[model samples]
Target: MSDGTGAPVLLRTDGRAAHLVLNRPRALNALNHEMVLRLGEALTVWESDPAVETVVLTGAGERGLCAGGDIRVVHADARDGDGSASAAFWRDEYRLNARIARYPKPYVAVMDGIVMGGGVGVSAHGDVRIVTERSVIAMPETGIGFVPDVGGTHLLSRAPGELGTHLALTGARIGAADALLCGLADHYIPSAALPDLLADLAALPVADAVARHARPAPGGDLAAAREWIDACYRADTVEEIVRRLLDHGDPAAKEAAETLLAKSPTAVKATLAAMRRARALGSLEAVLDQEYRSSLAGLGTHDLVEGIRAQVVDKDRAPRWSPATLAEVTDADVERYFARLGARELGLAGETGEPGAPGAAD
Candidate 1:
């Protein structure tokens, strides 16, 4: 199976399995627009192919499975209001994520290293999620003034109690065992054995590949800290949550609270609302659509610009958030984010090769 651009998916077929190795190690295989399109195309082909019984997705290096989207470009586009360009990236990326969720063929991801943000988007939704001791999974979007997109709400909401909300708001990192506990991974194997597993996957039949790659017993107890997480994050607003964390008298909880408070207040509130709504009412597609709306509209807002400026553009870590307190964020503000845009739609993609061509109009 060749990538449409001839860059190659590094595709190799054994008896009944195929392997898709993400090749751009330089940037940790971050999802550029082209890579996103290629992945969607590759998966579409494999889904229809009779001989392909299962597929394995992995990254190129020790750095990570992926570091998320190519945010440098996204930042540029955001500043320029490059909707025509950026919209294609998000639409196709979201479609690929949704496809992964619904894919029939058994899919596996070798989460060998750092798996954060968009990295979680691509692999976490697979049929068989594998993690190694090297795995470092996180949804680190709030730190950047962005909501966790890539169907993050679907997985995060399903996590124990408010841990999902805590992680989304705080952008905390979870190790392999903790990720497994959160239902993000199905197996745990030693990172040293990934090569052997890959070799087995590349040479053996689909069933044999799965058999050879069978993981060791899952490790550690991630649920031990669940009581603390739920307690610290249960408060209604960011300020309240911070106060609760401080009162808990746990050093880690206090540190997390301070870090979260330093982030954009509006982003924190909007993300919490998104997660809450995601739990009760929407499918992943609907969630991503809502996220896209927030992201699109957020670019012009104060937090996003300040966030990018403080975190990425300028080395200084101070961000001046508008309505800087959670108390300042109202239900009306949150609801306005979800309210229908007058005559506006995210205009999706179509099967045509021309990427910008919009899908059926809303």
Candidate 2:
């Protein structure tokens, strides 16, 4: 089965298992509006089907399972002066994330390559997350002038210690080992073994198949730097965190400080606060609600526009962020990102057939 448009998403079934392949290899399988809706619909259909014991998701190409959401469309939407397109995209995308998190059956995500931003939203929430040695994961949104969304706060917050804080603020990419260390992935399988693993999944129990294929992951950089990360990123404010990093004088600390400084000040502050608040929240739904509010707030800000312009449009690599300095973004400004959206807030309830199904908000 394919969702038309040259089958941006393709589905194949074997016995009790359904395999989903993201088919836009040219785009690195970046999720677009149509792809998001199609994926959600398929997941919803399989959710209640007794014959479908498991769902396996992977990208078509070797480059990545997904790079992220189609940010170019987002840039176009932002430039078009109506936030409707971006709004619709996020509303559906987030609901998909929620559905995956609450999915009844075993949902297996093969994080094979460059998974970041919206890609993480899809894979991280699955029941069984498989990462290969080639896997590269991150939430590199801050560099693009947006705070991480799609329930990123929930996933990042749950990472051990202050590692989530460090990753969120710096948008650092982590390998399979680090991804495992951060609780984002469950099994580590060598890329060469994935074919046999999938075949086993079709014949054996999902858990048994995974256990049979899983291999020991290499050491992660995050584990060795846990103390340093915890010490620097534990500060209440981004400025204080930077100060600590710079003062620490270690090469890694200085590099981290430089990375944070290059990001949008507004986004950095907002992301730091979101990660902090997410730690206190109990559920993924609650975290998504908060993330929705922050995303909406960001749509009205200048940083997102400038950030995309610098990073994507002009490829300038230098964004003129509003409130360019950390000191200029006061506490109240950061608080505004978390403000209640009231009636306009996301409605995350319901499953496939009920009210608030995927794309209902649009």
Candidate 3:
């Protein structure tokens, strides 16, 4: 049931399976507040339905799974002097992410094409995550003056060595191989097989669906790459990450470093801090809570509106940040990013510790 706003993120149920298709192909199925609300409602219904045994999530059209959040909407809301709607939108969206992470039923994300930003949130947390040859997975949040939200910090932190920190700050796009290597995705099936696989999942029983999806090919070693990433991104500040990248001299590493330097400083700093803290937390709720605090504060402080203006609205590809350099970003600045909020704060009050939690690998 869509409101005819942006695009209808359709929810269909067949037998004991639910199929979620991101329908905004023109925009690469970018998520909006309405889509998030609809998805949450559908998930709520499916969660309690005894008839629904599994859920398969995919994007409509051939472009992608989802590009990210609807930046146009975000820009308009920011201009209206009230970012409350945007904040509330993230709160609900993060709750949805938490639910997906903890969902008991077999949840599979069919990442066929460009799966990025908010797309990562929707798909990465699934019980069985799938990727194809065409899958272009990334956490390119810093590029848009936003930290990787929607439980991305959780996934990023779990990547081998300092790769998480490198990716989080640089906003690098990884192909299917690198994505599998980083543990961002679990299974890899040929793109041509997706239709048959989807049909098989839809037709099978819960246990059978879980059994049918093929295992992922082994990802290459990231430890070798980590030495360079750690060395280049070693500085305590976002600026240092870039400087180290500049010093590395490797073409790929140099280009990646330059990319981070181009993004908003505050976003990079906030993301760095967010990923660091998320690494120490246990439950999904705890990470989401901390992220909520960071996101809420980001509405007024971070360069989201300006970033959107340059990237989406104007397409100028030039965003003028407030604190342009990482050195301009102070400890207090980063500290306030983690400050608590009243009334709408997420409840992460009593989480203790879980050693074998998802994001604690390195």
lDDT of each: 0.75, 0.87, 0.79
In model 1, the worst 10-residue window by lDDT is 348-357
Where does model 2 exceed 4 Å of error?
1-5, 349-362
TM-score per candidate, in order?
Answer: 0.87, 0.94, 0.90
Candidate 1 per-residue C-alpha lDDT over 279-350 given as tens digits, one digit per residue, 9 for 90 to 100? 764456666666666666665566666677777678588878877877897877666555544444443222
Model 1 ranges off by over 4 Å: 1-9, 203-222, 342-362
Ranking by lDDT: 2, 3, 1
Q: What is the lDDT of residue 104 in candidate 3?
A: 80
Better of 1 and 2 by TM-score: 2
Q: Say which prediction, candidate 1 or candidate 3, comes out ahead on lDDT.
A: 3
Q: Report the CA-based lDDT of candidate 3 relative to the real structure.
A: 0.79
Question: Model 1: what TM-score?
Answer: 0.87
Model 2 lDDT at residue 119: 93
Ranking by TM-score: 2, 3, 1
Which structure is stronger by lDDT: 1 or 2? 2
Candidate 3 segments whose C-alpha is farther than 4 A from its true place: 1-7, 205-224, 348-362
